[model samples]
Target: MENENWKNIRVPRVSSIEKCVAEFDITQLDVPSGRFRIRIYENTNGKFMGFTNLKIKNLFDGYPEGGVGNGNSITEALEDTIKNFMENLSENRILNDSDFIFVNYNEF
Candidate 1:
């Protein structure tokens, strides 16, 4: 996959991402309790290097345990995070919602 040629994809700026949320399809994830929200963000830092970063947060707890995934595109970043989350689950390293990176929704 690494050898495959890639094309340029435009991503929303971090500062204006909230306004452009509709541009990207919102993905709903099934959790132990309920659904989770997957929000994609343009990695301003990765912009120079041509990569996007994603953050996954739990709906009930507003925790982003999945961490930031850097990739050539939004989809790649999201997939990486999901894979990591599943791996953690299989290892039983993740115990609860608190295991994720907590964030204040009001602050976003």
Candidate 2:
């Protein structure tokens, strides 16, 4: 949906991401009614080495609850943020930007 306020960008899906996203022990934070979950994955090698972060932002209030940190809601916010980051990285020839050194959550 291209518009005057913002341009549209497309991201080619990566099949290999399944393995990476699965490896991370997800750390999620959410306020009472707010809906958002951020997942960070660290790799020993590859482009997503240091810190591979994924965020799912909920656009509405209907986000379902799954366990303590699991939210059944599937929000596009999380996907949209990571997609933009990856696209820019690909353009800059940054095949290994996620390999940044370990640090606290605030640093990420």
Residues 15-63, model 2: lDDT tens digits: 2331123223333232222222244332222222223333222224423
lDDT computed for candidate 2: 0.30
Q: What local lDDT does model 2 show for residue 47?
A: 22
CA error at residue 24 for candidate 2, angstroms: 8.3
Tell me the number of clashing residue pairs for each predicted model: 2, 5
Report the error of model 2 at residue 32, Å: 33
lDDT score, residue 16, model 1?
Answer: 26
Angstrom error at residue 62, model 2: 40
Worst 10 residues of 1 by lDDT: 16-25
Q: What is the TM-score of each candidate against the true structure?
A: 0.42, 0.25
User: Superposing every Cα of model 2 onto the true structure, what RMSD results?
Assistant: 18.7
